[model samples]
Every structure is written in C-alpha cells, then in structure tokens.
Target: MIDALTVALGVTALLLAAWCGFAAYRDQPTKDWHFIGMAVVALLAVVQLVIGVVRLAGGDDPQQGVAIFVAYLIGSALAVPIAAFMSLTERTRWGSATVSAAAVVLAVLEVRLYDIWGGVGG
Candidate 1:
C-alpha cells in the first residue's frame, strides 16, 4: 500500500467515525453528508483494493496479513451502503445509529489495512 494514500484514507475514516459517533449519541437522523462521506471513503477503498491486488500480483509479500486485510477490505466496503439501507428501513434514530456504528467499523478497518502492510501505523 502507498503510505501517503493510506494516510489520507485514514484521516477520512477518522472524520467519518467522529461524525457517526456524534450522530449516534445525539439520536440524530443520518445526514446526507454522512452518506457522501461514506461514498467517498468507499471510492478510496476501491482504489486501495486495486493497489493491494496489484502489489500482491507483483509479489509484494503480505507477510501473513493478506487474509485479514482482504476480509477487512470487503467488510469496510460493504458496511456503509448496507447500514445506510438498513437504517432507512426503520426510520428511527436507532436505525440511523446503526449507520454510525458502521462508519466506525469502516474507520477501524483502515487502521487494520495500514497495519496489514507492516507499516508503522495505528
């Protein structure tokens, strides 16, 4: 993984997590901005996944981290959209809160991604 791009994705993840956390605590509706943020994060994740696969094909060792990293990637990619749709079904603050929780998951996955590459990341 490219260090700088991973850093950028991580920063985005952090912001998303904070926003989601606040939304959950306040029992607020999930905002469009939240969806937008998730979409952007997803887009970045797609790029990261591509890079990862390319590196793997190029013989960049995963150092035993590949399985978890790939799993995290799939989880991170699915979380936002799936949660958003599920949240919409309930129309309650708790439904929205599910989305917030998903955001946190996505953010945490980014950290895992960094560590998977054996970077001095957290």
Candidate 2:
C-alpha cells in the first residue's frame, strides 16, 4: 500500500468524523455537504482497495498476512457507504452521530491497516 495515500485516508476520515460530530452536537441531521464529504472519503477508500488488490495480485504481500489486510481493506471501503445508508434511514441528529461514529471507525481501521502492513499487532 502507498504510505502517503493511507495517511491521507486516515486524515480524511478524522476530518469527516469531526464534521459529522459537530453537526450532531448542533442537533442537525446528515446534510448534503456531509454526504459529499462521505463520498470523497469513500472514493479514497475504493482507490486504496483497488491498489491493495492489485499489489496482492502482483505478489506483494503485507507483513501481517493477506487475509487480515484484505479484510481491513474491504471493511474500510464499505464503512462509509453503510453508515450513509443508515444515516438516511434516521433523518435526525442521531443520523449525524452514526456518520461520525463510522468516520472515526474508519480512521482507526486505516491506522490499524498501516500497523498490520508494518507487522505490528494491535
């Protein structure tokens, strides 16, 4: 995986989390701008996923193990989309909370992924 891209994704996730957290704190629902931010994060995740898979296919393996790395990749890629769907269902401040939570989770997952790549255990 590309180190800079992974760092970018992790930072983006935190930023998204902060944005949604602020919205929830203000008693607001997930707004169009939040959705756009989510989309951008998700797009980054997808790109990472593709790159990871291609690298794997080309015989590059993570230090931790392929299974765990791929799992994190897929999970990170799906996190925002699932959260966005759940947010759409609620249409309340709680919806923003859900997105915020997901964003935080994604950030943590990205960090974990980096650790795994470097053979560090959680």
Query: For each candidate, what TM-score against the reference?
Result: 0.80, 0.95
Off by more than 4 A, model 2? 119-122
lDDT (Cα, 0-100) at 76 in candidate 2: 98
Worst 10 residues of 2 by lDDT: 113-122
Per-residue alpha-carbon lDDT of model 1 for 23-118, expressed as tens digits?
A: 778877777777787788778877877777787778776644777767766776677778878867766677667876777777777777777777
- Most lDDT-accurate candidate: 2
Candidate 2 residue-wise lDDT at 83: 100
Q: Over the stretch 33-60, how does candidate 2's per-residue lDDT look in tens digits?
A: 9999999999999999998888889887
Cα TM-score of candidate 2: 0.95
Backbone clash numbers for all candidates listed: 0, 0
